[model samples]
Target: MAILIDENSKVVVQGITGREGQFHALRNRDYGTKIVAGTRPGKGGEQVESIPIFNTVQEAIDETGANVALTFVPPAFAKDAVLEAAYADCQLIVCITEGIPAKDEAEMYNLIKNNTKSKLLGPNCPGLISPGKSNVGIMPHEITLPGNVGVVSRSGTLTYQAVHELTQLNIGQSTCIGIGGDPVPGMSFIDILKEYQEDEETNAIVMIGEIGGTAEEEAAEYIKNNITKPVVSYIAGVTAPPGKKMGHAGAIVSGNKGTAKAKMEALEEAGVLVVSNPTKIGKAVKEVI
Candidate 1:
């Protein structure tokens, strides 16, 4: 029982007529996701890769009984797409679009909180994959394999790197979730950590976190008190000059609360294995076993 998605999940593709949407939807279908319906505004009668397209998410859900949604809408309309999915009662909404305005995200966040029962994965993320089950996001299929460890991360490329190293070590994962680097997306490190801790197939966990935010600290607190599974974590942004911005704007550590050093210290004190080198993640995880 990995988090968010599993084999029984039936998915709908939002913005199905667009090139990106159609391509990934077909790919997801091929990857064993039950992609049963699609949404494309006025192209309601069209069929994309044999899946029926509808004018609204409600229409698609009604026709296909799709409980999950994979959205490929443009950034400008991404919030609207998510809201539509949430309102349609899609149990899981995976938003693959990046670069959503903060204000738009706030409104969407509030909408999801107040009105929708749907659980959101990401607005700027690679999405989640449960091995031998379903993959509904943009991550490459070849990198993952079924195993005992569950992977959760904020950085997309860094998540890939961790998976690659783990696969090389022949320790594949039960599920991997790229919760995204965005400030206001759905899932956080603590959220995924709770899910991973509850997952029976997952014997261990690997968390890839960036240098900013109090997220890692919060996760460390959770680990100290609740998480029982062996956890190995890597925090990025070690080389960035103090007070300078780096890759993701949200990755800058300001004030006393959100530095890489501080986060690592917290995790280490919690009895969580915190690795200094990103390249050594697999080896670090192996030590726990």
Candidate 2:
């Protein structure tokens, strides 16, 4: 089965009165996700595309039995929004806000890890799509297909590119998760890797990483010991200079650590097929499986 979300998920959009919240929520609904409820501080009793709006997450859940929360709140209020979802016991919380403070994100991440049963996807991620089943965030569903390849990525753009290429090669995916590229994303590469390894529908995996974090290296260690599926990987920012901050806040090289070379080398040593060129990632996956 698909990881994280599926056709049965009933979603509540936090800050659903906002432009981004309305657009993506309705779009995901059109993609067949259950966009059942929405939360706005004072916009209760309103409706966006017939999705009922409530004053709070708990209210939405009480009214619609919403098990998933998609957040489009501003950076300043992102942590509060996530907390609301977590405390409401939403099974899956996908936060799409990108400019949240690192401290705020870390606090939210830790609380979800230690105190709540809710699984948080991202604070700056593009959310996920279980193709032909559900779409929960801003990703274009046209580029995906229902198949056995599970994809996880740190970059939203790269996730789309990898999925597009895989679909082009006629290899569809089971579920694709953009775990976000924030310095303190709620979910990690290792976490999603475990889910992918356990997902029966997933026969292979594609991972898109960016330079500037030790996450890929950590995932490599876990994959070596745990995962049996063929995994193809591409690390972006290969040419980024040390101390240079790349597009994403987490994508920066420090001294000899967090370099693309180091991440690629680690994954290669772990028996993962690491592709040097991002464009050839789909080909690499095809070769392995």
* Cα lDDT tens digits for candidate 2, 1-289: 8998988989999989899999899888888999999999998999998889999999999999999999999999999999989999999999999899999988999988889999999989999999999999999999999999999999998899999999999998999999999999888999999999999999999999888879999999999999999999999988777887777888879876888899999999989998888778788888988
Candidate 2 regions exceeding 4 Å error are none
How would you encode candidate 1's per-residue C-alpha lDDT over 199-244 as one tens digit per residue?
Answer: 8889999998888888899999999999999999999987777778
- C-alpha lDDT of all candidate models, in order: 0.88, 0.92
lDDT of 2: 0.92
Give the best candidate by TM-score. Answer: 2
Model 2: how far is 164 from its true place, Å? 0.6
Could you tell me the TM-score of candidate 1? 0.96
| Worst window of 10 by summed lDDT in candidate 1 | 240-249
Instruction: Return the TM-score for candidate 2, rounded to 2 decimals.
Output: 0.98
